[model samples]
Target chain A: MNLMMLLEMAADGFGDRVALGPSDGGLTYRDLYDSAGAASVRFRADGGSHVAMADLSSAALPVSLFGAAWAGLPFVPLNYRLTDDELAALASRISPAIIIVDPDSPDRLTGIDGIGLLSRRSLMDLVDGADPPEPEWDMTGEGTAIELFTSGTTGEPKAAVLRHRHLVSYVLGSVEFMGAHEDEAALVSVPPYHVAGIAAILSNVYAGRRVVQLPTFDAHDWVTLVRAESVTSAMVVPTMLTRIVEVLDAEGPDGPGLQTLRSLSYGGGRMPSPTIQRALELLPTTAFVNAYGLTETSSTVALLGPDEHREAMASADPVVRARLGSAGRPLPTIQVTIRDDIGDEVAVGQPGEIWVRGEQVSGEYRGSAPRLTADGWFPTHDGGWMDADGFLHVTGRIDDVIVKGGQNVSPGEIEEVLVCHPAVADAAAIGLPDRQWGERIIAAVVLHPGASASSDELRDAVRDRLRSNRTPDHVEFVGSLPYNDTGKLLRRVLRSDLAHLGDGSTG
Target chain B: MPSLKPGSRFTSSVCTTQVIVVKGAGEVDLRCGGAPMLAAGAAADGGLPAEGASGGTLMGKRYVDQDETVEVLCTKPGDGSLGIGDALLDLKEAKPLPASD
Candidate 1:
């Protein structure tokens, strides 16, 4: 069905509640509903095939999103961090579009053909002045709701298409209507372009939780906002959580100083063990969730709940404690299977590619055919395994696996062992071409300040934990590793940076 | 009897109750307040709910038939109860999940 149905039900169920911003003078559910209806008239009148936002998160976000759905057009949010040329290139791809920009940079998207520009200020003005039409939206459930461009680490970015039915199914299956209390508020720091950012908006609105926006992420400002707004929950990427934990640790450890934050969820990348362990120790009362999903999956298909976090931390058994690193189990509506390279289902505790099938999984992209198999399972390029207890341990992207002498070696396994060393702050393992072996494993490491570890010592750490073959051929200490804004390690960048090691003359 | 499928909306003739089908298919006699329901947006004749069918429907709640083959989410609350033929729909219990967003 139409995404407008969710907003309509929220408006009808609790029209008077604050849906966004500060509670005292925020936009009410009815106000958001009316603004969406009014904004739809303008979107339809613009004669654009799609509605696009090239700005950060704000009240304008919800208005444009629902308005696009009401007008029966797909909403596209482009990364504002891109260069002018990059931004214009993407805008040209989605021509015949209305791109909403910040008032300060209204000229960001200028000189593009078939593109109408609307400053965020003027959009708000229209929302305030226009009259709402009657409740009417397409209900076929097949219209495109969002087109998100995957962060192109390897090559050109691919536009992933999420239809109304896919997104609505995600919201309906995972979230309850009016489940949140009136006092509950969620702090969102991720940019509008991320899939989690879009999911946060729809899920929070349907749950009747007021949203507090943080346009840019800074650990200190995040802590201040939680205190100022009495925010009850929040979601963050692993990098943001690491910085927040450092900020809390610097304050000295009676507590994290965030009393009202009852739930904190982290995803988008793998969480380092030290960061999560320190966070659990610092904020004992807060519920921590580790959600795992991809842009094609419409957000979280699996999550590790709070109780499991505590149990894993307290349990002395290594098997039970290792659950801390697991992604827990799949949602009841979703089915997850680990399959070998030939598409055969692998046994339990065996590493293979992750395949999922669910109503929420779109697995479709623009300008390409659907990626789903004839049987409806989508092969996620991610490598992972399920433990005996059914906990999913995601190793890393299958493309990043190092093939050494006809054996598949997961970089994540080596990096995890290296990071366990007290001297190592961060680590990354990449495959470099070798004459003797098909590929050689090179470990790029960043050491803690004033702490030192010999290359042999670090190699031994991995060899002790895993097979000797998994140990890195060489350990190169560096200042830091490269990670994207969303915390995904840029392995492609790492490979290019250390290409000299593969040269025989250099050795 | 009207053809039923997911995403179809219906309104009660006797009261203000409205629902969107979340499950079910094929033709069946879907009733509300002891009267046959009409497609959403259709005009309704003003009348009270039947004596035994006035259990009332709550907004944002799911109602399921005995076999659970049919499920509908009430979008508008009213004095009428949802049912099929003479069997009344039961309120589906919620399975609480932790907030992941």
Candidate 2:
């Protein structure tokens, strides 16, 4: 019911083990438990409806998260990248909350009424000096554990509510208690606001894996930290992985390889195939996992494990080779179905909206009705299909599907073919409004550094690989495609900027 | 006796051993040290464990019946083995799942 149960087990099972920060001298499970208890005391005294953090990842992240859980308050991690007005608006919404602020940026959030501000340093100091709170914690499952603001790539950000039971079930179903070896440590660079960040903390703690913090992520710094700390595992967004592959390639053969890293999982956005293929070649020893999940499904609902990656990449069968691009299978705890427009189940290999049902799938947003159906299935709005062998291939968001001449074209399908071309480094396919066709497919192409490709060649490549209808009506080579901080391609931004082009073929 | 359900927490009547049900749902004799386990925070009936029931429990280890019908994860360790009726539960070696996060 309470996430404290998971923490309490960790504290009881491996109290002396380092749970967070630098592996050599980080907070032990006992230290984290005590700090959380101390944090609960401060949070209860603040009389807040929630505990909020506006800073990047640090020791303060876990303390506030567990502390809030212990105190029976919803933990809200707001995006620090938001503008001042946006931050203030979100702060106002979570009024009467203890907002953990960055010490360097005090002026940004000061004078906000009903918001209690605690500097990160002061919060850590409080934990260091204070007595631990009583062990008693609310065990009910109905209380909200974390309220995360969706990235709102499509529209206005909604607060996605994850109850304690949902998270507890997710951790219990996916992770084995005290499963991690003593020397194992995981590097976490994803910002605190990300669902991956929260999931990383909870799963690692329950597995007894030590956490190494990376407050700011640059590929160089991430690679350096991995070597310096002997980090064995890590989770990254697709953008981070692309930069990391570039960094490793620059390191050359003699440079320190990712020898210590046993597992590297990437998600939160679509990963260009070339990057993952290059990464697999660069670090053949490391296991690559393709985790596909949304903010609504706790974290990873489906993951492509390392074995599948190797098999798919090495297999000669076309179907097996295509599995490399698939998200693999749904988790044992999750049930997934591809549904047609009428909400009926689609045939195998047929693309439809991905609907998932499980205890971990919240499908609920604050101030909005739960999105789950009466039977409990949540329409993910992601367009994907199940292969003959049960592998799930996510094409793209349904909203991102380009409807042209009464036919639906998946931008991802075209983007995949474009990226496979040697001259292309990245590609995003979007629909542009057209008078003749309901929507015209326009491809935004980011060529490899110093590489060039003509629109005809790219168009021929798509036309050759897929059907003629799937070919890009117009191809615009660009320096870079727009992506959010988490690596989700800003398709709307691309649509707006290129809207003026208006089926450039006509012009 | 309280019907067992997943996520339900129970405390040993004779020891500090506490557990949460990871699997199981029905009217069944779930016991610790040959004594029925009490609901968490329930008033304990202080007494010594029955003979042959003091084999003990390990912290963080999962115990399951032979048929795997009932499974419990120990939150706290104690000198009293967990059981279903008269059958002592065996230690379940947890298969480590692939780290997805």
Top lDDT prediction, candidate number: 1
Error of 2 at A487 (Å): 0.8
Tell me how far the alpha carbon of residue A458 in candidate 1 is from the true structure, in angstroms, after superposition: 1.3
**Which tens-of-lDDT digit does each residue in A1-507 have in candidate 1?**
889999999999999999999999999989999999988999999999999999989999999999999999999999999999999989999999999999999888898999999988899998995678998888778899999999988778999999998998898888889999999999999898999999999999989999999999999999999999999999999889989998998899675478999999988887888889989988989999999999999999898999999999999999889989988888877999999999999999899999999989999999999999998899989999998988898988999999888899999889888888999889999999888787899999999899999999999899899998898999998899999777889999998899888754222
Task: Give each model's whole-structure lDDT.
Answer: 0.91, 0.90
TM-score of chain B taken alone, candidate 2: 0.91
Model 2, which residues run further than 4 Å from truth?
A503-507, B3-8, B22-28, B41-58, B61-71, B87-95
> Looking at model 2 chain A, which ten-residue stretch has the lowest summed lDDT?
A498-507
Supply candidate 1's per-residue lDDT for B74: 90
Candidate 2 residue lDDT tens string, A248-341: 9998988788889999998887888998999999999999899998888999999899999999999999999988888989988899999999
Docking class of 1: medium
Candidate 1 regions exceeding 4 Å error are A504-507, B66-68
Q: What 10-residue stretch in candidate 2 chain B is worst by lDDT? A: B92-101
Writing each residue's lDDT as its tens digit, candidate 2 over B1-101 gives 75898778899999889998877898889999889999988987878678999989988788999999998888998888999889999998755567877
